[model samples]
Target: SDPKAEYIGTEPWTPKEALEGGEITDKADIFAYGLTLWEMMSLAMPHLELLEGEDDEKEVEEDEDQSLEVSFDEDAYYDRLGTRPAVDLEALGNSYRRMVELFYLCTEGDPVRRPSAAQILQALESNVPLNINPSEVIVID
Candidate 1:
């Protein structure tokens, strides 16, 4: 399944829960971005720890209403990637830093506050001056 296509919601909700119904908005996409960034840095997802046990052949044979796994709020992607080595992000240089920052900005909590894809693309296209090398900020366990 496409990770981004996954739904996230529950009723009688905890603070951690979100309303799963209705539209897939840019906010949803931004949340996905935050999840993605955490994945990139942690070399895994925020909470999930194991690879998915089932496959396409063993796909859940339930409708949305009948499905329990339909809206898992956990960070399953980090588990899917398995063990990964630490990355010294500082080594990426200034250009790479800009790119990662773009990822973070794209994933900001407020969808309205995050930059649009067009803005991101424009930033990438624009010739901006750099001071610090982006490749130095490292990420580890």
Candidate 2:
């Protein structure tokens, strides 16, 4: 695990209400785990926007303050688009991609909608669908 993984629990993944002076909870930890899981699976890709057109040089501006920052774009995240990195479902294959879906459940915009850590563990233990035929699995684009 990356040493900075601890930061996930405190910032953008820390739920909007918490940032607005609400009490933090175990749910925050679950959110962090979801994010860490995505990083682990995707080999730590930057959580940035897709480059427009053919200009491979297009880049999301970096924060000069920190060299190794994960995106903390809470606004775009709550709006459900720009902030998060894109996952290539076809490349990840079915099982790994399903694990990525778990991140969405853990990081739902509404805290109440996010799953508890126990629920996440139970789901993981119960579901072992990775070995299924890739052609038959329908991944969300």
Candidate 3:
């Protein structure tokens, strides 16, 4: 089963090509890495922790509707043209926030738009803080 369907929604971590049943590439791993990086920075919340343990048939149905609604909202907010993650700005500070922007690039809706793992590694190696303007900051996925 496509776990994204039952749980996490079509998050930035999910490759758009995979969702469309197209041929996926190493970029898919990069997409997942963006999400994992967010989770690691955001206190390690389990993927789809909100919908855990609703295995009963009845519960599943009920949860599905609610999940879809939440998923939709999340999708809108976390999308490339929408918002970003819900990390603690005060705690993470500006540098980490800039990194979030880079992660966002990794999760681009078009697989081709996403940065490769090697590019991401090079960016990380530069050791330069992203320094995104706070006014342009968006919400979390």
Output the number of the lDDT-best candidate: 3
**lDDT by residue for model 2 over 1-141, one digit each (tens)?**
232223234443455544554444455565567667767777753343444335645445557876644334455544542123456788888877667788666655555556765567767898743221213221111
For model 1, residues 23-52, the per-residue Cα lDDT tens digits are 344344444554555566656544444333
Clashing pairs in 2: none
Model 3 lDDT on a 0 to 1 scale = 0.54
What's the CA RMSD for each of the models? 13.9, 11.4, 11.9
How high is the CA lDDT of each candidate model?
0.43, 0.54, 0.54
TM-score of each: 0.37, 0.55, 0.51
For model 3 the local lDDT of residue 55 reads 72
Question: Top model by TM-score, which number?
Answer: 2
Instruction: Flag regions of model 1 displaced more than 4 Å.
Output: 1-24, 49-95, 127-141
Give stretches of model 2 more than 4 Å off.
1-13, 45-54, 58-85, 128-141
Of 2 and 3, the candidate ranking higher by lDDT: 3
